[model samples]
Target: MSYVLAKSQNDDIHNAGECGGAVTSIFKYLLDEGLVDGVLAIKPGDDIYDGVPTFITDSDDLIGAAGSYHCAPTMVGNIIQKYLYDKKVAVTVKPCDMRSIDELIKRYKIKKENIYTIGLNCGGTVSPITGRKMIELYYDVDPDDVESEEIDKGQFIIELKDGTEKGVKIHDLEMEGYGRRNNCQRCDVKIPRNANIACGNWGSQDGWTFIEINDEKGQELIDGAKNAGILETKSPADPAVEGRLKVEGIMKKMASKVQSVKYPLVSEMDEWNRCIGCYACRDICPICWCCENCELNKDYFTLEENSSPDPLAFQGVRLSHMSFSCVDCGQCDDVCPMDIPVSLIFDKLQKKYYERTGYVAGVSDDVKPPLYSPEKTEL
Candidate 1:
C-alpha cells in the first residue's frame, strides 16, 4: 500500500466536499474519461440528516454528492447487485459497504470487473431519526437548522446554517442511546481496504484527504486524476501517518469493547418473543438472495395461520444458510419491526466461525468460508 495526501484541483469541489474534494474529483475524472458509465453516491435528501443514494451519469451531478453525511446509513452493495450488475460504475463505500460488496461478489451476485470501489474510513453512522433527536436533545439546536454533522475526536459535532458548531461527547450521547447505530458501535472495520482506494481525513493536514492506494487500480485512479489535472497529490508526513494509525487503533479498541457488551449469546436473547414473522431481516440481508426458494419458505418452516413463527426454527435456518457470510451491515436490525437485535446473533456467529477457521467474512479475498468449499482427499 502507498499513502499520500491529495486534494481536488477544482476550486468548487475543493471548497464544497468534505475535507478535500478528492473523492468527487475522482468521480468526475472517471466519468469524463469514460472509465465508468455512472457514479453512485449519497446526495442530500430533504436535509443534511437525510441522505439518499443517487446514481449519476453526468459529471455535473457529482457536486450534489459532495461532502459527508453521518446520518446516511444506506448500503450500496444491494443496489449494485440488483441494479448495476451489468453497468460499469464507481462508488464510494464505507467498510460495511465494501464488506457487503465482497460477499456479494463471492456469491456471483455482482460482477467485480464492472464496479470500482472508492473506500472511505468510517467511524460510525447514526440513523437519521436518531440523529435529528440527538441534535435537538444534546446539541440544543433545531435539527432542521443544522447544515452538516461530523464525528471527530470522540465528539458528535454539528454545524448550523448560521455557521455555528456544537459538539457533544460521543460516549455521553451513546449512554443515552443517541449515538451511532448499535452495529456500527460494535464494528471494528474502520478502513475499507478491500476497495481499490481508501480515502479519509484522519492523517492529512487541513483541507486534504489522506489516501491509501490498495491495488494497481487505486494507483491508476490517482495517476489518471492527476494527469487529467483534476487532482493533486503529495506524500503524507511521517507524523501525520502515525497520528492516523493511532486514531484507527483507538476506534478499533472502542469497537472491541462495545462488541463484548452488546453481543450476547443467541441462546441468551429474549427479543425473539416479540418477532412478528415479518421476515424483514431475511429480506434485507445482502447475502440472502434466495428468497423464492429459501428453506424458510418451505411448508415445515412456515406458520400459515399464525403471525409469529418459531424464532429458533426461522432465524436458526437463516443463520445456518449464510450467517458465516454475514457482513453485519445491520439492514436486518434496521428493518426488524420488533426492534430485535437481529444482526447481533448473526455477527456473533460469524465471529465464532472466524475463531474456529481464522476466516473473517468479506475482509479478504483469498480465503473462503469452509461451508462453500468441499473436503480434499489425499492419496
Candidate 2:
C-alpha cells in the first residue's frame, strides 16, 4: 500500500548486497529479534550460476545469501510445503514462487501466519544448462569464469572474475532459443502483489531498492529495520515511482507479445513419445501434492507400454485433474525426461480456464478455482 526507497546502513551489507542490501538488512533484523526461526533464501552454490536455497538461522550468515541469481531457478514454495511447514520462517520469492505459495495457503497446505513472504520482481530466469551454453555460444566466454549475472534494460549482462563485463540483448539470445525459460518469457506477473512485501531495483538509483509494502507485516518489517538503525528510508520521488511503473509496463508488454503467439499443447507435440515415465515432472510440481493417491497411478491409466505411453492417457488425465491450477512455473518442462513441453499444455489449459472464469491460477482473489468451488461455477 506504500512505497519507500531504502538502503542498508551497514557498510558490509551494502557492499555485499544488490541494489541496497535492504532485503538482507531486513532479514538480519528479523533473526536478531527472534521474529522468525530462520530465513530461507538462495545463495551461491558451486558458483554464481548454481543457486542453492539455504536456511540461515544466524544473522551473521545472511550476507552470503544476498544478490540475484537469474540462472538459478529453484522452486521455494514446494520446499516449504514439503519440509518447513511446521517452522516459522521468512522467505524470498519470485512471482511464480509467491503464486504457488498463495495457492497453497488457500488449500490450507501452508499456514499463512507462520511465514513472511518477501517477493522479488523478476523479469525472467535462465536455465543453468542453457545459460552456460548461451554464454559460450553468444558471449564467447567461459561460463565458469563468470562471477555474476543480471538482466537489465533488455540485456543479459555478465561480470567476469577479473571485473570485465559483457552484455547481449535478451531478445537476440531468446530469438536463437537461448535466453529465459519459455514459461518465464510468457509470465505476466512481474511483481508479486500477493506477497507481504515486494523488493527490487526496478525504480531506484544505484544504491537503493524500491520496496512496495503490501500488508501490515511488510510495514512492520520496514519500520523495525529503520528504527533498529540498520536501514534508512524515504519516500521515492515522482519520477522514481513512475519509472518503476514504466519498467513494469514494459516487462508486461514483452510477456504479452510472447503470449500473443499461441502455445502448443502436449497432444500437438511429438516429444511426449520419448517419455521414459520417470514421473519427475509430477514430483517437481509445487501444486501437484497428491503424490500418495494420484489418479495417474491407477491401474486404468497405467503406462505399461514401454517408455512411449499414450499422451492422452498420461498427460491427459493430469490435465483434467490439476491443469486449471497450474501456476505456469514450468517445472514440468524443466524436469521432463522426454524434453516434452509439459508445462505448455498445462499453461494453455490454465489460460483457457482464465478466458472463461476470469480466475488467474495463483494470483486470483477467489478462494478456489471454479472447478473446485461449486458456487462460483461459470456455467
Task: Compose the digit string of candidate 2's lDDT tens values, residues 1-379.
Answer: 9999999999999988889899999999999999999999999888887889999999999999999999766578888998999999999999999999999888788999999999999999999889899999998899999988999899999999999999999999999999999999999999999998999999998899999999999999999999999999999998999998899999999998887774642464466566666778888888888777886666666556444345556666677766678888988899886778877777777888888888897899888888788687444
Q: Name every residue pair that clashes in candidate 2.
A: none
Winner by TM-score: 1
lDDT of each residue in 168-275, candidate 1, tens digit only: 988999999989998889999999999999999998899999999999999999999999999999999999999999999999999999988876645524766677
Cα TM-score per model: 0.96, 0.95
Model 1 CA deviation exceeding 4 Å by range: 265-269, 303-309, 375-379
Alpha-carbon error at 60 in model 2, in Å? 0.7
Error of 2 at 40 (Å): 0.7
